[model samples]
Target: MGLQHTAFMEEEVRRGLDPKLARRFLALVWAQRGLVTLSVVLLFLFRLCAVATPYITKLAVDRYMNRPDLPVGDRLSGIQWLAVLTLAVLTVKIFTHYFETVVTQVVGQRIMHDLRLRVFNHLQTLSLSYFSRNPVGRLMTRVTSDIQALNEMFSSGIVALLGDLFMLGGVIAVMFSLDWRLTLATFAIVPLLLGASQVFRTLQRQVHRVSRAKIARLNAYLSENLAGMKIVQLFRREAENRRRFEGYGLDLYRTHMKANLYASVFFPFVDVMRAAGVALVVWYGGGRVVQEHISLGTLIVFISYIDLFFSPLRELAEKYNVLLSAMAAAEKIFGVLDEKAEVLDPERPEPLPDIRGGVEFRSVTFAYEPGLDVLHDISFTVRPGEMIALVGATGSGKTSIINLLCRFWDVRLGQVLVDGTDVRRVTQRDLRRRIAIVLQDVFLFTGTVADNIAMGNREKPRASIEGAARAVHADAFIRALPGAYDAHVSERGSTFSAGQRQLVSFARAMAADPRIIILDEATSNIDTETELLIQDAMRTLLAGRTSIVIAHRLSTIKRADRILVLHHGRLVEQGTHAELLAAKGMYARLHELQFEDEAGARGIVQAGEPSDRA
Candidate 1:
């Protein structure tokens, strides 16, 4: 059993030294090189001083026992010298411990700080597609829980393991120096202790892995359900959600219980073994002392050494669990760090200067997944200052076209050109800076209303922010609030209505002063009153900029310079509202289907069928 445990530990250590883990661990330590080195040095010095204390005690015991007839002056002097030596060693031990703790904490915090920032920055650089595929809770776990686990490994686990190793070595050396036979006798149970540690560590690691996974799943479930609490409540799913949550909670509890069980059993087993070792040492060493083969001091020292040896063994057993957890966390964190950004700027890219907003898609084709094209080989052009409306059924590639034009994803075939220059030739930052997007699913950060509006233009003056808000007609409502521009917006802007958030987003886009603007279902969620307000804002914002409006409301597109109707990733018709209605094709059918109850369709027909509009 002892040999098996040793071999298993050796294997685990070998696995831990794998190139990837080694690099990550070493990098974390190297980040605080000065503190790490100091901690190690202090730990080594403290172990040396601790090892010498028992020897000093042994010397005093032997001198007192062997020199009963010594002169009083010599005896007193000898006692004083021993006392001084013991005091010195104890003082050094105390200071060493203090410094070790200080250094370890410093190193741990620094490494954690760097790791967290790297994770956050990488998350920001990842494409939207990656975010769409991963849940927010899962990502949060990597940043918070995983980094915290590593902090524990560095702050306590590493120091404990190192201190135990040094102490164990020192104790073994002193024991052998005192009496080899007694030392061998004391070590007879070492294999058994090692075996038990290995078994406990392996079981504990498995339990911890299960526990962490369960916790991650629970977090994900909680985040999802909370975000959609309204839907859940409306559907009367309280009991069902509770039942599901209970299952996840129970899974975590079971895993934690299993880990505790392993720990509980291992400690008691180790204590029993320790007791047996102490008995063997005292019985054997006591006999040797009676036979005068060894002094009483030697027996006492042997007993002390026995205790010292087991102390490290016990501590090592405990630290093994922590080490395993840290290793697991390191694997997860490095996996995130190793993820390369799929969307990166071109090397030696040309800088975009003064964009004219002439966007041309030349036979562009795209797909979120391979062999599944969302936008087929479609081509179109939007001249400067032209208002183009894209009308299509859901999944007709209208949004995909805007996405391609924005360089969110590059075209799989042909190219997207801005002012006859391939978008791929310039940096995404430069390209995006020239274009402003107002999405239907408006997102607002947690901050004051002014901060949210100025997000797109950080250097914009306060007056500019207020002016933009006024243009979108958001100023009236914003000022009506308690804090006006300073009113706090909660996360996701839940405090405000959907139409209000949309209007705020529009104001934000207008603040950026981009050459090209995209309104993606911008008015779809707004009421008629708000839509009319937004229509006026849109006309003002689009006056001198190229605009692409994706609208589900047919009435919104009737006044566009030209309307393109898409069906199944293909352009089925391109004409003004009146011309399309006259053509009596897909557009006319779609218009009648959507606006049959409204008088806007008749007003559109009454307007002259202008060719330039198409």
Candidate 2:
């Protein structure tokens, strides 16, 4: 399932141009019509100036420089004015080109900015299953390199291709008007130029498409290894991982070189063809000049126009690479945008009425994959203000239950109701606002302690943030730090210990002040002393709120109002701790295992005992 995106990327690359996708890209341009219009106007003016320069040169040579029929003074005066006119035309062309480049660049940046934001916002709306299936590196390529490719096309490829076409047309028109026979003779090499372009286009499509896909795979691989670098080092897999990375890097290098090889051959082939056209003009048009059948100025103009014609042809060949890459990138980016969110809000929603912290699972069933149910016919209820503990082995659907409760996932069968309303009846935003979950692996953003505590809500007063931290007993260590609440926290809060990070997570949950608090193995990783601190903090954090606790430590849940034991996705037992022990069922067996493990190791009876199950 994780490799599905890689396969899709490869397939999309192999596919040829899609008109539907081209139309979509055109629509993006249409959205910024004003900037595009200005760019086009500037480009037209530049092309006009480009066309005028050669004609002015012809006028200088024929009417002013060579025509003895005119007076010597008149010829001198006319030649000087022609030089001035030539300078003015060149100056206007330079300014128009500058403005055109600037406008196109602005359009490209604005479009890329809008597109990146759209992809980001769409990702946020997708269900957790989508993220679980896709790699972060692959998505990063879509938002970064892929969009940048489109920007390159917009900034340089599209407008330049248009300008090149116009320049070619303008040159051909003027040359044909001057001498049709010479224009036709010089254009004899057009067939060879066209043949080279066709072959290069085929090669470019194949190599560039594969190269882009390879880049995406490389990024995904790097992101995976870097994120798990600690595990790699612990397992002594550095040399092995590097070999794997080298393989990826080598694959990308070979693909790019293949594309470069095709370009290298094709570009010089264009130059040779351009030289062939120049030779035809020198041999054919030069003879006509000698026979007095054409002016020397007309022969020179023919040479100049031939250069103008082939120059754009060469540039169009170059810009085609950027165009192909942008097309492939657009397909991938649009694919992401088109992903259908599995969980969507109803067209019309029923609002929750006066939400209390009551929760229920009525015959709920779930599966992360088809035909593989993780939770089957599970039913439970938690009244407002009740603290219930879920006891289960790993893969026994404990976390799945929490996921459903939080609406991170929806049940496949039956209902998960909160405050007597089906969770699907309301927007996810409204539903999750009432629940705050603390997991065993706490995640903290890069910010100050207070910023993390407030969780990006600027409206959260400093007094309130500090009060929440103090409630979780995190204030003691926080105050000991350099800046106290204002201290800088590095990425993922790497500066904090596991226990300290957990304590801050508790503070975050408390700050939200949710009506329902979920502790999903929140204290399992803490040391004995740190656990004692959090155990005291939990009492205050969970007070007056409905709480659900999932833990491997049996002692932590001994004080729970009720305990439910699960095995293999089924509810096998439920009762108070002492009541379940007296019954001697699965719950009693788990308690016995923990009790034996703790007693044998420490020779001390302590409530802080670990269980072998989640």
Candidate 3:
């Protein structure tokens, strides 16, 4: 996501699973305690049925088969009854397994749903700075793959571990009851098994940690590359990009191979241990049975119990990998949940009802980074219904001023007031609702033209949408499109021309009926014809509303009520367009330079017309 997020992830991998993180994760699951408890109960029932199967077979052999003193009919009857009981046990085991799988999976999915929504909601509350530092793809991984990992743990890893432990416990108890000597023989191999498992876990955890990081980086790279594919093609970077992608893919491949290598050696070692345990049972228990110390049935049961015991051990080793992966995912998810929003509403916010659109910035000094101010002691005021234009060189804090007024970033020093009430004193939602911003780069979601104009405010009636469109001169072109206003908009309004998108953006701002309008380089991308249309529409659109327009083009803001020229984050000049020009200050110089550039551009075009005729 960011350097900080990446560092934290690496630290978590090095530190391994934190019990505190696991507890926090469990707390989320505990919110659905009813379903979780039911799933656990079903698991236990399944285990009980599974354990009974071997014992029923033992009972048939020990009680019925060895009783030769009984009549044939009685013996046959007993055998038949025991067979039916075994079938019944098998039936119950199958049903219990079915129900348990269904319940556990449902719980897993419900938890995923809740967690996904929780993460999404938290994302909404985070400040814009957080998003600036994090990429969309990395954050998406947190919501999608990471949450899926936790779901896998719930469905298979954690639940399976519990079930396996329960099975192992039941098997041990039954084995010891039949013959302590044979049970002790099986116990001898467990220490070796445990040692092997410890080694495997350590190795696998590191692999899993690295593996997760690799996948996340791969996703981020893929996302970034795909988003910029047009540039890549224009630059002919196809070969270079493919090589880089191959490198990422190979890195992931090596990680998986390393994990597989470890598993290959470890699992076979576990099987050898199981075989050794089985061999021990046969050797020691067979002699005991021959000496009449235990029945043949008891010896067979010991062997069956031995298999059951080792089965869990093997399963536990496998589930441990899933557990480690889930732990890492949980840590990352909780990290996001724990991030406090840099901008927050005061516990008791001042009410800002019926805002009258007057804005004031009182000696506002701000910095995106400490000790590096972007805006230095900036002070300005806009009376209601006044249209002021901000003109400056790039990075002279023109857009930063807009950001402060909108409270996108809080001022480090002094107050930004809306209608003389400190903007910070009111909730951001309340303050922002009174302002509408139309930026240079307008972002439109994938939806219909009408939807983009409404911008998720579904309460706007069809008449208002159309009226706003017509007011911004967007209605004419929109009605000419394939489905008219109902035509589909591709991602980021790529389907529309640059001018069309800008017009739609203006319409959107107008549809909001905001008290204050912000047009930051809003007309810079429009052609001359479209610009004239917008300028004509803006006279009517901006009437009786406080508007702040920031543009690089001098001609666009020539008629502003007043012009403020900024130079290196300071207010160098402010006055009516003619007044600034008469004073011969920074505004005059900028205006002259732009006029010369336009003349030079016209000369070049006129010069090229003769070559075309030739």
Query: In candidate 3, what are the lDDT values of residues 1-614, reduced to their tens digit?
Result: 23233322233355477889778878878988998888788888889887887887788788888878888898899899999988888888888889889988998999999999999999999987788777777788899999999999889987778899999889888988988888898799889889989999989988888887777777777878888888999999999989977877887799899999999999999989989988998999899989999998898888887778888889898998988999888877888899989888989999998978899989988888789888888898999889898877767788788888888889999899999999889999999888998876778989999999998888989899999999989999999999988899998888788888888988998999999998754454457788777776666668889999875445546657888878777888899978988999888787776644754543111101111001
Give the whole-model CA lDDT for all candidates, comma-separated: 0.79, 0.85, 0.82
Task: Flag regions of model 3 displaced more than 4 Å.
Answer: 1-14, 522-529, 599-614
TM-score to true structure, per model: 0.90, 0.95, 0.93
Colliding residue pairs in candidate 3: none
Q: Each model's RMSD to truth, in Å?
A: 6.2, 3.0, 5.0
Alpha-carbon runs more than 4 Å astray in model 1: 1-19, 65-67, 71-84, 522-529, 598-614
Clashing pairs in 2: none
Single out the weakest 10-residue window by summed lDDT for candidate 2: 605-614
lDDT tens readout by residue for model 1, 1-614: 12122111111112332466856787778868888999999988888887888888899888864678888788778989999989989999999988888888888888899999989999888776667666777677789988898899878788768888989988988888889899899989989988888788767776666555566667777888888998999999999989978877876787788888888899889888889988998899889999998888888888777778888788887777777777767776777788776667788899799988898989987888889887778888889888888887777888888878888777789899998889999999899988988877789999889999899456889999999999889899899988999998999999898888988988999888899999765444457787778778877787899999886555667778889888877888887889988999998887776655444533222111111001
Best by lDDT: 2
State which candidate, 1 or 2, has the greater TM-score.
Answer: 2
How far residue 456's Cα lies from its native spot in candidate 1, in Å, is: 6.8
> Which prediction has the highest TM-score against the true structure?
2
Positional deviation of residue 412's Cα in model 1 after best superposition, in angstroms: 1.9
* Residues 1-614, model 2: lDDT tens digits: 12244432334465556788878888888999999999998998899898889899999999989889999999999999999999999999999999998999999999999999999999999998888778888899999999999899888788777888888889889988999999899889999899889889888887778778888888888888887877999999999989977877887788888888998899889989888899989999989999988899999888888778898988887788888888889888998999999888988998875578999999999888889898889999999999998886677778888888888888899999998899999999888888898877778999899999989999999999999999989999999999999999998888899989988989999999899999865454457888788877888889999999885555556778998888888988888888998999988887776655764653222222223121
